[model samples]
Target: MAEFTVNATRFDPYKNFKFRVKWDGKYVAGISKVTSLKRTTEVVKHRHGGDPSTSRKSPGRTEFEAVTLSRGVTHDVEFERWANKVWNYGSGLGAETSLKDFRKDIIIEVYNEAGQLAQAYKVFRCWVSEFESLPELDANANAVAIQTIKLENEGWERDYSVAEPTEPSFVEP
Candidate 1:
């Protein structure tokens, strides 16, 4: 008889609770949430002059809503730097609306426990719409400091390749 040895490994469902975010690949930061969607379609109808009115439909322009990404406030001045570069602080509409002030996209890469990419999404033509207000701080309260970043992007698409787990045998989250 020949002797054989065996190794046992446990397979657990993947977790996507933790994730990292990037701002046009320039700055990498922690992300809490990112949500946005295309504008709803408006229904239009056309009626005949004399007889009963016929039905007609038309689709409105494709518009994107503002996306909000919440995260723990960074200790550095990265936020300030980015805002200054993208948004005009001084008076004038020129600063607020300029092609030179917008970023190409914002990417979010979610990883598994093994540091493997679980899912990813890229938001295109993102520009800072709002910095969002900072939460109140109290000496007596015990809580983590968090802030949200609002970005208005034209559109977004998911990275299907990255969304699929790299591991050959892994459970979906």
Candidate 2:
């Protein structure tokens, strides 16, 4: 397994951000999320095995294997035009005074045993908050910060498809 970091910047609110993951030179998974945080670290796990207990006839033994393609990390993230304007007030305006809500979407994809796209999952998070003595732009920064942390801390995983070989025919002479 191999690990890699994806940096997201110059975000576009209408467009979705995507990240492709490969293992052992094969497409393993992909992730897409709305651009928000300055950076996000993604950890992916790849493995194969089965449980004997689940089967009527145990295989006698069970095998477990896993590879960590990446570790905990933080990458730089940039916000889209609308999101940036909503968060930062670099134009010398006072901080945001009222609380606001922001929504972010994330997508995860994984392949099946036949080397085909098997599954995809979509998740979302919302941020809301109120601040005192806060400028209009900064009022929601705290909410966004909290939402970002929650998403990163959450563990993400997806299982690959299982393929079985067909039996061959035998002819007697």
Candidate 3:
């Protein structure tokens, strides 16, 4: 077992802008934004016959929320390739969706301002539930073209093995 150490000098939290998403042991490029990871559990309310007028609450099934990832549209086909695993457009009647090797495990890594890996999360059994290849094109608009993918995952947990790194201090010359 690895010992955990605290970085006492880190007064501020990690910034959200320095992060990356990886799958298949490789990083996906140009990921501009990612939705927050969330989960909800249902509460089961039950009452006993002997109880006067109060009901008891118990934990029920927990469901993980879908995460959406957005990136600038480019020639990279990573988004479209993963989306096709769910449902292909022109592939035959019954062979549209590829059942085997469809779901994948992904990692979201957060980096500190100094470009050090601060934290990471492992998302399990993720598959693209929704995908947007291209946003509405407007020649008049100056915004960049963007593509998105909504990933439905079974669950996600923090990777505790990634210990907090000791922040570096620089002296001015």
Candidate 4:
């Protein structure tokens, strides 16, 4: 993302002025009009939306609102892509850790198609060993661990099978 800085000054009609405005890009002289000095000053101040420390909500919210309102469709598409990527990754990882005595906090960093860090989500998986009723290192624990391994392996098989579908139904009958 490009860093945007705002530069504002009194519109001098007599003297030629040139300055780059935020988001609007480069602007040259005679582009902006200054009808009344007092009125223009009032309008500029109003546009600035008063002091930052004031109770009034910050202009950042306005900037976000403007961007979101303008790029609603883009935002939705980006969100869907992000969600799909996260789900695909999670599906792979979820099978591996399920029913095992793994850590509760698993952080997954999701990236956009442009390879930018979009967002992060936490995955919490339950373990049979963590349960009070299950005996430690007993048949039940071993069974659960075996189940987890099977699940993980099965997930990988499913992914590969989907990538190279050999079944008659998948051949488009």
Number of the top-ranking candidate, with lDDT as the measure: 3
Give lDDT tens digits, candidate 2, residues 1-173: 32433224313232232334432234422222223323233434333466444323222322222111221222322222223433555645565422343443444444433344434433333221221122135643553221112232122333323222222346998
TM-scores, all candidates, are 0.66, 0.25, 0.96, 0.16
lDDT of 3 by residue, 17-91 (tens): 999999999999999999998999999999999998999999999999999999999999999999999999999
> Candidates' lDDT values, in order?
0.66, 0.31, 0.95, 0.23
Tens-digit per-residue lDDT, 35-127, candidate 1: 644555566666567856676667756777777777777775555555555665674876654567556587877777777777677788876
Candidate 2 vs. true structure, TM-score: 0.25
Q: Which stretches of candidate 3 lie over 4 Å from their true place?
A: 1-3
| Tens digits of per-residue lDDT for model 4, 105-155 | 223333333343333332233112211111235654433311110001001
Ranking of candidates on lDDT, top first: 3, 1, 2, 4
C-alpha lDDT of residue 95 in model 1 = 61
What lDDT does candidate 1 reach at residue 164?
46
What is the TM-score ranking, best to worst? 3, 1, 2, 4
Residue 20 in model 2: shift from native, Å? 4.6
